[model samples]
Target: MDMYTFPFDTQTCTLTLKSSGYSDKELIFADVNNQQSLTTESQQNQTMGEWELLNINASTTQPSNLVFSQHCITYQITIRRKPMLYIINLIFPVFCFLVLDVASFFMNASESEKLGLKVTLLLSISVLLLILNDKLPSTASQMPLIGKST
Candidate 1:
């Protein structure tokens, strides 16, 4: 599929529309999950679906505003993937910091011991962050590429 970007923000995307018996509200009622593919042959050849980024202002809600018209009934697709580098970078260093914090508790307390232990813990955190940062992929990708920014 060609890269697509919605004009605006939309919580949901509905697909597979028909010119007849199609209601802006009711169309969302169909079980789009069972739908496998979308075709616009005999269909209206219009947009049966829409790109949210295309939303003009917040006035339009239906495909009428989004696509001139739409054909095709509906289709279903699956989305899946593993945790991204952001997730790894976020949780990994935080996890290591916590581990180091817990480790600091094991140190014995004394005059020089207290000073050394605090310095050691701070150094450990810094080192852990450096190690964690190094482990992350370069080029600096954005966070939560899907939903939210971590």
Candidate 2:
């Protein structure tokens, strides 16, 4: 499951553990037999991409006796994005190329010089796009906001 926000934001994901053919009555939950301890172990050891763990909350839910269900323990993990370095290192160069392109438009050059400048800018932007395409999230439904803006 991809938990990506379109515009460079952080998100939290909840993971639940439910067993088959097990209920609160059959599988008693106590200080010794509980999921809270497991949750702590998971949070301490688990690592997700580029996101830093902010907090983890774990809780148990006892289902009604009427329906056959397993005891559920929900683990909510909050993560924050670490995108500042990438923006400066990868995206800043693209912005510079864009500015150069815009400046080329205002330059009073000969037809050949202008054509050469346009070609160079196009090639530079194309190379930047190719580099960025690999770094960006391909599974996203829409293009990245930065790419769209530029």
Candidate 3:
């Protein structure tokens, strides 16, 4: 899984097939590329809300039968979300505030007014950070890149 996109990511997962009751002598997969030997697809229950299939590939591996050697299939999948509202609500205002803060540097405000502007911006940014703290995954192994940039 490419989790760098966290909450919005795609993944390639593998499914391994093996015979538990019989070893390679009794039960062995034929040509791994043969679709009939592996799995089948049903059109009725195809897609899910968060994920969709992109492609799939099948392959065979060398038998190393301590317990059971396995055949494997790889699935390529894409993740989907409805993030328009999230971007508009959480990102737009902060972007506007940052732009305004940059513009304020060139304005001809007095020293006291300029200091007040900076302070106001700082407070707003702090509030945004606090709010974002709750929205982000606390158990994430590392800080999110978006949070680092912010």
Give the number of the best model, judged by lDDT. Answer: 2
Q: Give per-residue lDDT, candidate 3, residue 90.
A: 65
lDDT of residue 86 for candidate 2: 68
Point out where model 2 deviates above 4 Å.
1-7, 24-49, 65-69, 141-144
Predicted structure with the largest TM-score when compared to the true one: 2
Per-residue CA lDDT of candidate 2, range 57-146, in tens? 777785676477666777777777778756875678877887888988898875678888889889988887787777666675555555
Q: What is the per-residue lDDT of model 1 for residues 1-150, given as tens digits with 9 covering 90 to 100? A: 211211122233344435565554545444333222322231334343332122111112235554444334443322222234445655666667678777777777654676776787788777766776664334423332332435
Which 10 consecutive residues of model 1 have the lowest summed lDDT?
A: 52-61
- Expressed as tens digits, the lDDT of each residue in 96-142 for candidate 3 is 89998998889787667888888899999889878877865466556
Clashing pairs in 2: none
Q: Which stretches in model 3 have alpha-carbon errors above 4 Å?
A: 1-9, 15-76, 80-86, 137-150
Give each prediction's root-mean-square deviation over alpha carbons: 13.3, 4.1, 5.5
* lDDT for predicted candidate 3 compared with the true structure: 0.61
Ranking by TM-score: 2, 3, 1
- In terms of lDDT, the poorest run of 10 residues in model 3 is 35-44
lDDT of model 1, residue 150: 50
Give the 10-residue window scoring lowest on summed lDDT in candidate 2. 1-10
